[model samples]
Target: MIQLQSIVKQFKSKNGVFNAVDHVDIQVKKGEIHGVIGYSGAGKSTLIRCVNLLERPTSGKVIINGVDLTNASIEQLQQSRQKIGMIFQHFNLLKTATVYDNIAIPLKLLGYSRQDVEAKVTKYANIVGLSDKLASYPNQLSGGQKQRVAIARALSQEPEILLSDEATSALDPETTDSILDLLLEINEQLGITILLITHEMNVIQKICDYVYVLEKGKLVEHNTSIDLFTKPQHPTTQKFLNTISQRNLSDSLIEQLNLTGAVIRLTFVGESTGKPLIADVANHFNIQPNILAANIIELKNGIVGNIVVHINGTPSEINAITKYLTNNGVQIDMLGGTTNE
Candidate 1:
């Protein structure tokens, strides 16, 4: 239930005026986890900040639930912001305050009653699994525990939209997965709309329903997480996917192996991932398939598989095999080497 229209945020630098976030448009539906991904300095962090007018756009509309935040009055904007919660890459908690005080402080400042503040803190601390750590200060907790405190503090506001700005980047892989799982639970159980910006494709792969790919302050691609992962169109997007999937083989490795025949990259999505397509091809066609690299990933939608293989066969036999695989819902990309065309 959030829409950003023609968003542009420019900054003055020694080089002159530059758009940190160029003209971009984004729509995040209610109760869905939408992700914006880009490498460092890709303007993704700046883009998410514009959602809550934390960084006001140069010229664009920031609409939340049909209200144009760009045109909102000071009081209105403040009121609107209370409905939006944000967590940062670094767990921004008061170091001296105990977890209970850190979560209760925001509610206290919001004019919540002492009893109400205690209740909200208790409820959210339990939700984020920090009930036992309420007495511990930030230094006494692990990185994951600190983030849980941050999450509990944010949820204390009862926000409808949660903005996560690289929330898991600072944690280790195991801790990252646990934090992601917690976010997924918050989205599913609380029905909160989550808009997270991360450079990690693994994060997007795990929880995002839809994905927006940003590069150098512009929107390059947007699609369902399944479609984007299965068939990445942009080179930048492909590079990000490669980080986690390893779908492409290095040319040096390919050359060193001295592979023969047509080298093909086959992509399998959903049900096709379970089929014996390679075996079927070998049985039906007079071709020998030598698999080079294979990877299967599970996304929010389902499974996607990427297999690189070298097929040794005559022109007609290779063509027949390619056609057979294509007919069975396999996407084929010729990496290098001979093909029937």
Candidate 2:
């Protein structure tokens, strides 16, 4: 397990003291993959480095497996860090070294026996599907293969936690998916507590069981992946969700034109039965809603849905329908056209 309490990291910049990570608190439970997301300059990288004492926090606690790393001695921290392995966005490998040696480096540093290092190097390389590339150099491998080599290197040490800092950012989409799948597989089979930091919401959505949204050194929102995806509360969080499910300005205008009256965004989740509720609205109000843009992304939670619709009816009728829909557990936001909420 990993925890950061009021973690702060500041650097003396030309303009002033710039805080890369400010008063941030995070807890990554054992056996769960937690995601941290933010745009460039959002301090996500700095925050992760602070975790293993790679970069010391100015004032805070970095606790790993019950050890407070911030206050730990160099010897203590070094020993603790061996249990926390990290991989970079760029595969930081010795280009001339074979994949076998690349992975063996970490074990070698720990003073592992030559035989033990060889066994682990081979085993981790195989785990990452690089058995054939053990003798291949970094330059000869593809981006994904190189990343696998890096992963094998990190896992070769057999760390309890893996801090993946934008580990897939440099790869193509196909390769990105492959890397993410591998991370998930590692988490599932190895039960390694992973803290994956990236600007990519899609990555977080795919592998993260829980996620936190960070902006300008502050925690904007944090929740389980399913809850955050279905019902994002913060504006920053909404923008991140919209990155993958972008609703264009032109699309909004089209919905407005088609509806020509009241428009509402409807969301459905657990205990909010949408089919019967919509049927009841139709029967009671004699109004049909022209559904505009609709999307249903299944999460670990039950099927959650969002739809843009134009309800055609008299003013009073629309008001009645809105009230009826709300009483049934449908979360409706009046992204209105002519109607005022």
Candidate 3:
């Protein structure tokens, strides 16, 4: 429902002109939660801002539902923006206003009747689980509660597309999870297309259907969340995935520990995650399998299993085991191991 085509946002600095967001293209399908991820200064925040023309691109098309926002008139852009809501890293709520009023502000500004404003404010406040806190001011609420207020305010606009610019970054881990869960529910129940930018892979892993990896203002990789997690192509993407998965074993650590035989990384997807492939390899190959590190990630699509194992066996035995595992739909990476044919 949202398309950002060849987007470029440049800024004049002491060093000369630099692209905060380079030529990037992103398409967010309707009703799907799409995530943009990058570290600080990776241009993720700038990229999301370009979506709503909050930071107009130097030269690109910002299309929403087939309307090129870049070419839209002032009135048309203002009307279009009403349907695109945004929440920020810091809960941007009026401290002087109560939660109810905070949510009602948008409706009131849009010239809704007093009764209609009350109805929408109440409805969205409840949707964001802030019904009871409607009377509370910003200072009286916790970080999560404040974000709920922000969400309620945004939803009160009845936006078709929700842009979350690191909305959960300021909260604690537990609060972040709760907020992410709330966003997932909003997407599923309201069918609002969500485009959120976060540096946290855990957030993307939890709710995103598709993911776009940004680095130094460039779109390095974009793929289904499942594919990105299982098979990350770019080094930057791999770096991000490593943050969530213990798939990397340092060469020095391996050397210091003097790990023997072959060291391999195994990836199991879907039903393979439930299989006894490790056990089968041991029994069938008559080789010992020592697990170094492992983790199971539950994605929106399915479960992904990652295992790093140390094995001691002859070349023939290791090859046989690799073949056996491969035939059973397991992905094998030679971490520091005998090459598998």
Candidate 4:
């Protein structure tokens, strides 16, 4: 539903031009939750802001649905923006306004009648699980409830696209889960296309169907969550994946340790992964392998696991075992011990 091409955003400063976003291309399918993740100053917020023209790009195009947002008139842009809703890290609600009025603001702005606005705001509040909070003020509510009020306000517009800028960053883990679950329900139930901007991989892993990894304002990696988790290509992407996945060392790690007679790490995937591949390999090699440390990842579709083991066998025999395992489509790495985050 959204397409960005060669998108760049630069600001004039005392120094040379600063590119908050640099030639980033992202395509978010309709009704899919697309996540953009990066560390601070990585241009994640700039990229999302570019989607709805909150931050106009210095160069490149912003295409939403079929409209060319870059060159659209102010009125047209405002009209198009109504189709997209956004929420922020802070609740951004009027402190004196009741939850009902906070959610009713958008409806009132759009010129809805009092009865219609009341009915819609009540419905939205219920959707965000805040039917009882309509009478409460922002100061009287918890962090989660305030966010639910923000969500109710955002959704009150009946937007097709929802842009979340660190919506859960300010919440606790339990509250974060609730908010993520609500987003999931909105996507599954209402088919609202979501563009979630955050620095947390755990957030992406939890709900994002697809992800775009941004570093230094560049689109370094983009793929399905499962594919990226299983085989990370970019080094930055690998680091982020390791935060959630099990960390195992490779042949280089073992070599760095400088105490490897024979050491190999085995990776497990899918249903057969948890089974004993070690025992079978040992039987074939006529040697018992000493397992050091292991990590297991039960992903959305399947499990991607890793185990580090110290091999004690002849070079030719161990090589034969690695070949056998590789032939079976198992990933093997050499390591001394598990690497630290």
Q: Candidate 2 at residue 110, lDDT?
A: 81
- Relative to the true structure, candidate 2 reaches a TM of 0.91
Task: Please give, for residues 1-341, the per-residue lDDT of candidate 2 as tens digits.
Answer: 88999999999988999889989999988999999999998999999999888899999999999999888898998889889889999989998799999999878878999999989988998899999988899989999999999999999878999999999999999999999889989999999999989999889878888998899988889999878977789988988877776322245685547555677777777767447676677778777787777776555335566777788676787878878877877777777666433
In model 2, where do residues sit more than 4 Å from their true spots? 247-258, 270-285, 300-303, 323-329
For candidate 1, what is the TM-score? 0.98
Model 4: how far residue 204 lies from native, Å: 1.1
Q: Candidate 2: minimum summed lDDT over ten consecutive residues — where?
A: 246-255
The TM-scores of all predictions, comma-separated, are 0.98, 0.91, 0.98, 0.90
Clashes of 3: 0
Candidate 1 wrongly placed segments (more than 4 Å):
339-341
> After aligning candidate 2 to the native by TM-score, how far in Å is the CA of 298 from where it should be?
3.8
The model with the greater lDDT, 1 or 4, is 1
Off by over 4 Å in 4: 249-258, 262-265, 283-287, 298-302, 335-341
Per-residue CA lDDT of model 3 for 148-193, tens digit only, reads: 9999999998999999999999999999999999999999999999
* Model with the higher TM-score, candidate 3 or 4: 3
lDDT of 1 by residue, 45-152 (tens): 899999999999999999999889999999989999999999999988999899999998879888999889989999999999988999999999999999999999
User: Which sections of candidate 3 miss by over 4 Å?
Assistant: 337-341
Model 3 alpha-carbon miss at residue 106, Å: 1.2
